[model samples]
Target: MDQVTAAFDATPRRDFLPRAVRRRASYDGPLGIAAGQTNSQPRTVDDMLRLLDVRAGQRVLDVGAGSGWTTALLAHLVGPAGSVLGVELEPELVSFGSGNLARTDRPWASIRQAEPGVLGDADGAPYDRILVSAMADALPVALVDQLADDGVLVVPVDGTMLRVTNPGAVVTAHGRYRFVPLR
Candidate 1:
């Protein structure tokens, strides 16, 4: 398997899921967690990671990190040299995701609560890669501005998945995908 797939395989999904739905951890479908948030499907996560092309020593931003699954996976890909910051709007989910990520022993990855309507971490601006799990009505300008010179951002806009590149100058649509709207 490729590196991304290998990372997915190595990271235990069960660890990131809520106890009640732990049994379906490997189901490959989205499962609801608390606060009306749902983990993205495994396939969708994989696809987005592939598009992001994350690499070791490359800092990444994970927007709408529900259960910290994507955050942990990105941590694995980025290794110790890189860092990952996950932003969630829900306070409970921020705690939940932080707790889940703590188990991974990856100090480089962390989850934090974001203010309502905030797109990305401005304080942690200029991310090498950014992955948005939730769908936005349109491209979030703030997030686009946060990308590094050659950064890549994979986000769901309208009903399609878009891979935005560098300074947010280019946008390529991947395909249709359903996701919870970004709050």
Candidate 2:
């Protein structure tokens, strides 16, 4: 199986889901979380992670990390040698995501709150791979700037899934998708 699928299989999706929707954790569709956010559908997450092509020791950033499901998946992909930083705009989600992540016992990954209007984590700049779970009206410059040379960023922009590489030098649209707007 592909690395993305392996990561998905290893990580328990239900662990990141709210208790109210825990029964539907294995459902293929998105489910509501706190702070008016919804976890990205399983297929969408799989597609993005495949496009990202994460390695075993790369630094990754997960933006709009609502429930930390994707973040945990990334952590699994990166393994113990690598690290992942998940940034959320909502304070409650930061706590919720962090709490969910704590159960994994993976010290290489963490979730924190981002200031309003901030698109990515500047403190963790030069990410080897970046994934944005929320939709943006246009490509978020801050996120692109955070990419290392030849880095890949998978994000939803204007209803399309866009894979950006080489620090915004190359952008490929991978068809349509729905996501909550990035705050």
Q: Cα deviation of 102 in candidate 1 (Å)? A: 0.4
* lDDT (10s digit) by residue, model 2, range 57-92: 999999988888999999999999999999999999
- Which pairs in model 1 have colliding backbones? none
Name the Cα RMSD for model 2: 1.0
| Model 1 poorest 10 in a row by lDDT | 160-169
* Top-scoring candidate (lDDT): 1
Q: List lDDT for all candidates, in order.
A: 0.92, 0.91
- Clashing pairs in model 2? none
